[model samples]
Target: MKINILIPVRALHDGKRRLSPALSATERRALTGWFFTRTVAVARSVLPASDIILVSAAPDLLAYGQEAGLHIVAEAHPGDLNTALRLGAAAARRKGADATLCLSCDLPFLERNDLEAMIATARPGAVTIAPDRSGIGTNAMLTAPIGAIPFLYGQNSFTAHSAAAKAAGLIQTTLRRRGFACDIDLPADLDSIGFMKNDRHIIAAE
Candidate 1:
């Protein structure tokens, strides 16, 4: 299917700021590194290393992706999340991608089977979203023929993405998945069982 996966991560120094009440800046930065590492591992488990792309302006993170044998799409600058995603998607399309999965870098519980399920059920010309636990934010999105709809990632982004897809005359579906829904952003997000096991969830057992 010439599938490509894009993961957009903010520079470590500027990430996880919302968790300031529970984590110091240094701690948050360290946790950002950990989250990125684990998210890359999960993505690798689902797709070939060459098909997984990390988009970021952070030199260290770009280096990490290169060292990990993943495709590195420079974000140019740490601009808005949606802009970074658009850049990544464009890069993927130029690389001959027929489908792209835009994934969140903080999905600590993401499992390969979750990706497999979404891929298996994805309909062409459709926008498939995996929403966060709160069902208000998007954790992952799959779109065929990349750039079918504008990327709207932010507060209440799940609704925005859905509306964009419908407006584009594309089928829109919300794919509920435990692993894909469990992104870590706040102190309360640490309560998932997968987090306790450090995300060693079943990858091949669907």
Candidate 2:
């Protein structure tokens, strides 16, 4: 099946507001760039046949996504992450993708193998989520049949996704992968991942 990955990014200035306390504005921008770069790299590595779509309101981010060899969907709406993702998913479906994976751009450690495993395990009328380090936040979600479930992302998103899946009568599965579990949101999270140095490549960034 052709899996299309949708990465929704808000403006660079407001991208990781939660992470601002841990990093300076410059550092946050760099971190955001690294995060987006790593996400695209992982997608490229994992699904060679799969297409990576980046939906963002930031012009720089769109350029970066293009540089990363990903399809860019410029967000007409500036601040709405959900809307951007929805548009991207719709575009993917229109492009004839068999499945769509909505992945958070902050997962620096995500591995190609884990994504492959998730794709292999995917089933019709099912939704899969990869919880964050706290096991409460959702870092990655896969919805078969494209728009099977409404993507509700935020704090406690894992539970919300599970609830949505149950309500929709879709089989729900949670896969705990180390790569997908670690996301950079706070200073402590950054330290915990030991990603303090500047790394251009995904493997080194992680």
Candidate 3:
């Protein structure tokens, strides 16, 4: 399958609000930037660079993504997360992508093999949803034919997406891979990243 990976990035300067208790605004931006850089690198390992699309409202990030040789989609301002992902999927389909996987930007532990395995589960007219550690939010989702079902990405999105897929009569799979499960959103998420807590070197990577 000609799959494209769509990564929706919030503006670097206004991300990770949940981490405010533990991280200063500047530190949150820095951490998000670091996460994006590594996420893109890991994505490239599983798919060709051309198959990765970055969707964001930040002009700076869009410019950087273009410069880095990844497809860039300009998300409309005031839109929700699902809207950005829908725009990204549309953009990918326009570029001849047979399927698209929407990935969150906070997965610090994502690896190539895990992503590859997730993509392998996707077939034409299928939907694959990966839940976050809480099992309520959706960490990653794949829809073939690019837009098989309406994007249901928000609170309790894992259940919403599954219901949508079932309603659409599309094949659905729920994958609970470790790398995809551990998206860093809260203070507890930071504590869960064992290696990052012990190794300042990795956390401070620029």
| Better structure of 2 and 3 per TM-score | 3
Model 3: worst 10 consecutive residues (lDDT sum): 197-206
For candidate 1, lDDT tens digit of each residue in 106-182? 87668889888878756679888999989999989999869898888999999999999988899877899888888
lDDT of 2 by residue, 1-206 (tens): 77898888877667677877766676677777767777788888876523888898789888887877788898766856678888889889888887888888888767889888788778888899989979899888888878888878767888988999999999888889988998877778877977655645422332
Full-model lDDT for every candidate:
0.83, 0.80, 0.86
Candidate 2 lDDT (Cα, 0 to 1): 0.80
Off-target runs (Cα >4 Å) in candidate 1 are 191-206
Candidate 2 C-alpha error for residue 204, in Å: 13
lDDT of 3 by residue, 118-155 (tens): 98898987898889988999989989877789888878
Error of 2 at 56 (Å): 0.6
Off by over 4 Å in 2: 48-50, 197-206
- Per-residue lDDT for 53 in model 3? 95
Q: Which of the two candidates, 1 or 3, achieves a greater TM-score against the reference?
A: 3
Assess candidate 3 and give its lDDT: 0.86
What TM-score would you give candidate 2 relative to the actual structure? 0.89
Best by lDDT: 3
Better of 1 and 3 by lDDT: 3
